[model samples]
Target: MDDGFIAKPLGRRQIDQAYPLVCAIAPGLGVDQWRAFAAALLGTAPKGSGPGSSGPPAEAGIITVQNALGYMHGLFSYRVEPNLRHGRVLSVDNFVVLDLFDLAGIAETLLRAMDLLARRLGCAAIHTTLPERYLVRDSRRNPIPDCFRTEGHRQETIRFSKDLAVVNDNAPAVAGGLHGVE
Candidate 1:
């Protein structure tokens, strides 16, 4: 079943084609916004220069799962970053899988691909926070966690975030502290 699908790095040329899948995951996102975000992930300039343009580090990219006929069913964006505790870690986000026919297989394939990419990049670990929508405790609609467990991945943390009030960009740094020292 997994053989019918191919997991490949999403290229700059296919950004437009991949937008729909991205929209499925983020409904309110605009086309321009999606294009720019995808371009950054692909390490290509938002306009003019093509796929190989230097933007983000080479270790970061978006991967998509496509069927034999070339339909994108899912995707995830990832970047390798230095971590104080882990040395270097591969962090993935925007994981989406649209093919319900073989959700388990697709999820497994994506996870395996991430593991291989992490190893290739010499990462100490692979970290990803499944989107909040996927954590609703409904097993019927979410099988990704099960796939992760089957692949030997354990849930190490539950993340919590509280949005801070916006701060002025030109606000003066506080005096006599590390905030302004750097």
Candidate 2:
């Protein structure tokens, strides 16, 4: 079925257009921050890399799904990294889909694209974790998990995280010294 939707690597020209879609999932990220991050992911102009540089790491990039009208509906950033257990693996993050009406189709398309990308990169496996905010408490009511399962992906591990309190760097240093240490 031709839904007039296509998935392709995000280009430097569409960074602004894709920013809104990214904000839909990452609400706290600012435009300037996202611009730099996207630039790095796109391997166009990584930090400290001069003009005509070789670009960022070859393993990292961002992919976006756009409609026939040239509007971004979803995006995911991925990088191929060496893993202790899986050898070289393709890790996906920041997966965001704004087209709620066709969430399943878009999600599936993105997953398939990741699969192809992983193979092309010679990755041993592909790992993806959906953002917690996008997941529903009711598993049966969530289509994201089903879409992943239908695409031959399995839930292998559960992730646990805790937000650490940020400390002010400008705060006075405590007067303490280790015993017998300079």
Q: What does each candidate score in C-alpha RMSD?
A: 5.4, 6.0
Tens-digit lDDT string for candidate 2 (1-182): 13677777787888888889888877877999999998887764244321122333347878888789888888898888898889999899989877758888788778877887777678899989788866677645777777888999888787775554454434444569544455
Q: Over the stretch 106-171, how does candidate 1's per-residue lDDT look in tens digits?
A: 887788778877776788999987877677564365687878888998988898855345444544
Worst 10 residues of 1 by lDDT: 45-54
CA deviation > 4 Å runs, candidate 2: 44-58, 165-182
TM match of model 1 to true structure: 0.79
C-alpha local distance difference test of each model: 0.77, 0.77
C-alpha lDDT (0 to 100) for residue 67 of candidate 2 = 85
As for candidate 1, its clashing pairs are none
